[model samples]
Target: MTLLNVENLRVTFRTEAGPVEAVRGVSFNLGRERLGIVGESGSGKTITGRSVLRLIRPPGKILADRMEFDGIDLTRADEKTMRGLRGRRIAMIMQDPKYSLNPVMKVGAQLTEGLRQRDGMSAADARKKAIEALEAVQIRAPERVMEAYPHELSGGMGQRVMIAMMLIPGPDLLIADEPTSALDVTVQAEVLAILDGLVRDRGMGLIFISHDLRLVARFCDRVLVMYKGKIVEELAARDLMAAKHPYTQGLLNCLPRIGGSQGPLPSLDRDAAWAL
Candidate 1:
């Protein structure tokens, strides 16, 4: 049941200085499971996700020995094929809804647009599903919120709406790039729960990209620790503490513990040899 497979995936950007390799020879396979990618900024976490969707802009190039989705070779997929896959078979929920949602559009129109247009559902049916989608994400007053514009909803509500919009299409895979990075701890948990429930119920795959080690460890089935644009470690989420890679261990060590002795936080000690 391998939904997506990638091997020796390399992404380079044409910078003024020269070509910069953002992702170097990274590879992984995803099934109907939750896979978490964790790393600091510029560690290639976001770039890797974007590469899957072919979202990299000009001056950026994606190259892979093998990149397949559902038995189709993505490395050779043309724009037309990619368009059918992106947001249909594979959807991405961005880090923030404020930047993702349309500011001027009513939430109802935004949510039901896909269903009405793609699924051939009547306007009434689409509206019904849209409200159900909102309810699925635990929005209590979905009807009231439907009429409200994206700018009017709270941060958490806006995020839930984004999730509902993406899921309404029934995508096989969801790439959530720091979906709750902007929310509070409580809201983060709530959002993750909703995503987890939908993924499980619909038997869909998820690639969760985030910087929160603890959250990934708790929520994901497997964890991939990226450092310097490569996967330095891959381990079961429950066994994250037993990660053997130096980079992963160093990341775990940097977390500040509550009720523990307080002192100057330990700085990460990098080993040049680890990158090779």
Candidate 2:
């Protein structure tokens, strides 16, 4: 059931100030279940997800003792091999559809581009599949949405479109990087529901990266808490409140609970040792 296995994974960028390690010695195994990576900004959660798909470019280096996906060695995969795996076997849903989708292309074109180019699907067949994908995400009037451009859709609609596109290929693993960060609470719930359904129905492994500790705890099966470029703790989602790490405990205490604490939320008492 283990879809991915990563050990001592490191992602570093050759900056003007010398090498900066964004992800340091992060290791985890993912099965066909939701795995949440939670942390504040610059904590390397996003980098860790991208490293699995070998998306790090030059100047940004990825190193690992072992990085495998479905028995294939990701650390040693060439660009061509990685390309085949990406989208087809391992799809990634970025933070924002506005930035991820092409501005100039229509929604239908954007959705079917991969199908036609990579899968060698014919135009009519690709269009039919694209419409089905849109429908699967609960987008009503799929044909109309497909004809519209990215700018023409609302935030929630655009996000659903993104989810639909990623699911079109029926990937085994889905890495969602703050997929609901920009949406309102209602929209966030809907998006989470869609993702949850995919995991339950399709048996797809999910790597959900987010800064919202509460949301991650609610939606994910297991949680990995990251801080200063490394995993601080890993625990079941239901046990998040009872986490043993000070970092996790500090994060939980920082959340402003309604009707519970009218006082100022506590800030993290930074520990130098947490990073080490």
Candidate 3:
């Protein structure tokens, strides 16, 4: 049932100062279930997810003792092989639609481009599929939306479009990095529900990377707490509030509660040894 198995994974960047290791020997396995990776900014959560798809370009290197997807060895996969897997078998939903979507391209074109180019789908078929995808994400009047450019869409609408585009390909494993971060509460909940339904119905595996502990706890089945490029804690999502690691506990303490306290939030105290 294991869909992804990453062990001793390391991502390093060749900086002028020295080689900066962003991901340090991180290891985890994923099944057809929601696995959330939570950490502060620059904690390597995004790096780990991107490494799986071999998305890291030069000046950066990904090394691992074992990085396998299903039965395929990911560490040794060439670009040609990776291209075959990228959107067809594995897909990623980036943090922001404004940055992720093509600014100049019409939404319809962007959505159907992959199908037309990669899958050899005809224009009519691809358009039909794209419209269906938009509908799946609960977008109203998908036809009009498709004709509009990315800039014409609102934040929530843009996000829904991104979700639809990513899901159109029917990937087996999805890496969503802060997918709902830019949306309002109502939109965020709807997006989460869409993701949840897809995972449940399609038996898809999900790697949800986010800084929102409360959201992850409610949405994901399991959680991986990262600190300074390493997984400091791994536990069931329901038990996240009761997490034993100082880092995880500190993060929970940082969450703002309504009517709980009138004082300013406490900052997370860092222990130098946690990085070692």
lDDT: which candidate is best?
A: 3
Q: Which stretches of candidate 1 lie over 4 Å from their true place?
A: none
Best by TM-score: 3
lDDT of 2: 0.94
Tell me the TM-score of each prediction against the true structure. Answer: 0.96, 0.97, 0.98
What pairs collide in candidate 1?
none
**Residues 206-246, model 2: lDDT tens digits:** 99999999999999999999998999999999999899999
Q: Looking at model 3, report the run of 10 residues with the lowest lDDT sum.
A: 255-264
Cα displacement (angstroms), candidate 3, residue 115, comes to: 1.4
| Total residue pair clashes for candidate 3 | 0
Candidate 1 per-residue lDDT, tens place, 58-85, comes to 7899999999999889888899999999
Q: What is the Cα-based lDDT of residue 132 in candidate 1?
A: 95
* lDDT minimum window of 10 residues, candidate 2: 255-264
